[model samples]
Target chain A: METPLSRTDRTRLGRHAERAGTTRSDLDAVLDQGMVCHLGVVVNGSPRVIPTGYGRIGGTLYLHGSTGASSLAASPSQEVCVTVTHLDGVVLARSVFNHSLNYRSAIIYGVPRPVTDPDEKLAGLRAITERLAPGQWDHARLPTRKELAATTVLALPLTEASVKVRQGPPIDEDEDYALDLWAGVLPVRQVLDAPEPDPRLPPGVPVPPHIARRATPTS
Target chain B: METPLSRTDRTRLGRHAERAGTTRSDLDAVLDQGMVCHLGVVVNGSPRVIPTGYGRIGGTLYLHGSTGASSLAASPSQEVCVTVTHLDGVVLARSVFNHSLNYRSAIIYGVPRPVTDPDEKLAGLRAITERLAPGQWDHARLPTRKELAATTVLALPLTEASVKVRQGPPIDEDEDYALDLWAGVLPVRQVLDAPEPDPRLPPGVPVPPHIARRATPTS
Candidate 1:
């Protein structure tokens, strides 16, 4: 339902602008496919990028951290960037200059606001938990009132975002294509291997169906 | 030969200081394990994070982009943060508050210097190429003089960096451990699927061993 607008002055692509997607759905696809994002925030007059899990509900992306995390606590006041990327393949060309990676990525720039309302905070936490492992929120014990109070959730609007995607085989110069060389795409995949149960688990606890089904390729 | 010193004022870990590694080897391991890095820079008085490939040789890391790329060109004078992250697993705990991700990440902060010397420029380009596809750099045709001139390579010192690693099962509160719930780690792996040769490649061209070997787990 959220149609992303054209690039604004701040979020415009600087190079290879053709790869930038024109629709907001493209941004949603990239964000939904990724499990983790690199959050860039300024600290002590410099930039710090932290890798963490995030969730998107409609037009807002939610990121939560410990209340004690100075970076997240400071993020509300300063502009921040959240980037999610999926490496699809390695583009091997006949010439080194033409080599590239096939990837889909979304970078969101916004000034996040702290989610102080208890209802929104809980919903945001559910979104994040379900993003990492679907159905786990219902299967596992929910957060307690005290736990919710200790967490800090930041909501970033997707209004200012860019989605760039590149795929398929390498595009080399016409002359280079005649060369006798092995050139193609090597597909990359992120998969969840067999689940490992905790050493302290009671003898008969079974792995839930939701977790078991994830042993396949993700994207 | 590079022995990383103790945390300095710049590289000091602000949160979860216990998870930060103290040795330089830790930084090297994180760098070598990753192919893509999120580069964070300040543009128009706000943070912008871009994802790109990088390579490391000894104490320096090299990044390349089109000479016209505003973000890379603007990075030489201002402070930039290059972060490489590997998502290892999903840590599901009995309590939602205790859920975490097992990951290894390195964040390097420095002012990148433009590599103008031809020799270092070529070498840096080789490092970047080989980092993505190991033997393809040697097998493929090297960049021409014109291509080299059009590219911009920047070298960021590895002296100021922070490495954070989190692994194993979630550590829930002692009382919460008594709950009857399934909890453990779901390992994440990045793997290469079989190569898809370019449709236009000559029939006799064979898949190189360098690429065939990557079908296994990357890290």
Candidate 2:
């Protein structure tokens, strides 16, 4: 269990301040709830952050990318930052300074190693596919030799990750309570509607249960 | 108008490629919809991307901080890459290689300058405040002279900003199309529910229209 670090442990989120009240379960939940993550790294000394799809299996994160000259895939033992954030809503506070966002996010710091084991690489691919669209792995064409070779998978252990969360309404000074300000959380949520089949489908390809079960609201 | 430059456009959302169009309005819309952005810059000849709040007034972007000795803000004429992305959903394709995300994002490239003019500084701060919480600016405490002196705001003109959008369903290869693959959009939506007032409110503080508006849903 890693508690969220804060600037002063005064409740303000901080780094290296031992305020990291985060749990492995917290990171797992956030990762399971999200598919895309912002991969941050220094490229030739300039911080580059790009959002992309990622899959988590147990204690490791597998990011599938092209081996073809991607700055991310080309890195050699460089420090990387992977962030997954879920926006809960716009926290509308009474004061402008107090205005903040309610969100659940996790930032993982590590040096990813390229996956070279063919068996593990294949398993890694399935994790990513199933994570994105549940029952599609067996339904779709598996990666070919060349295509698999062209793909780059980076496996980053999920250690040293920080999960920071902020929920509820604004907490103002006691005196400001009477300032005639409206304070509350404008809750934000993500919902999935019916899945729209491909327009080019030849017909009669029914939706699978794994994918169909997702047509409702997910927390 | 600036379009985001990267393989993100040409690689992932090829099906919705043309619909991946960007314009000045799109950029502004994204700017208005977001309160925080990932600030990317070369820190000490290496890249470091940090999440920071920014307010964009038309083509000018205002960002301020009080880190005191941030390697990023301290730079005078460094080239910076700023990205504002609103995540739509995690696109879980049937194939690991095909996994993607549905998102609307903007990337701006600029040479930032330290704001010096007093009036411009005031306006920049206001822009930031208003951007974060629309109607709360007038109700909040304005930055004091001492606060202003300690904080530094950088003005990044949107002279080279670009937008990249990925929407709609996953497009698999022709052969894979025939596979009984469960494919479609797990449509990502943001919902804004009723506001929750502060527990300690003194009463008589009504919710403002800006805070009352519902979330904008786009498929």
Candidate 3:
């Protein structure tokens, strides 16, 4: 059986509360679809939001940075908010008052634990790499012990997370629907273009099928 | 001549400092290209990052939310971090240790002021609308007084901001470049797909050319 998602007071949606969901699967879907997330932490008594890549393994979300960076080095004791957002479409309404974006966003809140165990650290790093490139973990060279020692990885449990989604066409007032104007959704998609090989690469290395397939739009 | 961007100690880049830029144009480019941003604010003594839409006019950035939402309500006093990010490509290196994303991001720090004047509110609303869909404000119905009263609009000066950018292929170590593997970048672009009109519309109302042109990729 799968565990259900719970919202502590921190994760509760304050406004537009109707869009919030508490299911673990909903949290998983949003996490699985995104490659980058904004890590929010308070620095010097002020909030600082940094954009970085993340990967989820089971119920734990892994984020890594230089051991010297303040965001990870100072994250062990305090609470952090990690957010992943996907822009699905632009909702153009008949009135400026009703304009909105169709999007799916997940925000997770928790105090992260430092990953010190070697076994779990490798696995976490693998998940982060594979999430960005599905087959590259096995295709590329794994991290060396020295390299791992220099990096700092933090794991934030997905215990308190909220998913808010706004989709479909804009809802205009009843009177404005009659106005003679264009109204619809301009769908936005993140597509991968053709791969560009490194200039120093050998003459015969062909683009791997795993990377080539991503050239087409997925989701 | 355009005013150059200045960086306060808080806005200075702390890590990967090479990617940071203090030019005001760099800040403008990132903001103009993105439609959605994550607004980080402290709510209930914990950091909360909310994904919302924003618009920029000159040195002021405008954000709006329902008057009942706590994020906008509490934003007047405390500092807020507004981030706009564009994921340019996925950098797949020869080693997992060096895997990174190519992206452009802008982080702005300031205390947002509540816009009280009705004229500035409408102008701000128009800028927000037109930024999302160019020529949209002129094409859509203007907001009514009652609708404007129900929304809360906040403006923050662009003076205290920083832009960080990372681009190009992955940078692998000297030894790892000798490995026999495919290594390159997968360019990611946000493209607009064909527009889907509202089904309830009259049969003959066609999509305006301004909206139709967006069907093709720009930038």
Best by lDDT: 1
* Fnat per predicted structure, each in turn: 0.84, 0.57, 0.82
By DockQ, the better pick of 2 and 3 is 3
B144: Cα error in model 3, Å: 0.6
Off by over 4 Å in 1: A217-219, B217-219
Tens-place lDDT digits, model 1, residues A1-219: 758645787568877788988678999889888889999888776777888889989888999998988789889878999999999999999999999999999989999999989889988999899999888888888888888888999999888888898999999999998898999999988888888998888999999999888887444
Return the TM-score for each candidate structure: 0.97, 0.83, 0.96
Each prediction's number of clashing residue pairs: 0, 24, 0
Q: What does candidate 2's lDDT look like per residue over A1-219, in tens digits?
A: 553322222123443334244667877888898866777766545556676778888889998777764566545488777777777866665555556777777777678888999998988888877776777677666788988998888898887676777777776655556666677777777677777775666577787787778876533
Q: Which pairs of residues collide in candidate 1?
A: none
In candidate 3, stretches whose alpha carbon ends up further than 4 angstroms from where it belongs are A217-219, B217-219
Tell me the tens digit of each residue's lDDT in model 3 across A82-189: 999999988989988888888899999999998999988888888888888889988889889899998888899999899998888889999999899878899998
lDDT comparing candidate 3 with the true structure: 0.87
Pick the winner on TM-score between candidates 2 and 3.
3
When summed lDDT is taken over every stretch of 10 residues in candidate 1 chain B, the lowest stretch is: B2-11
DockQ of each: 0.73, 0.47, 0.74
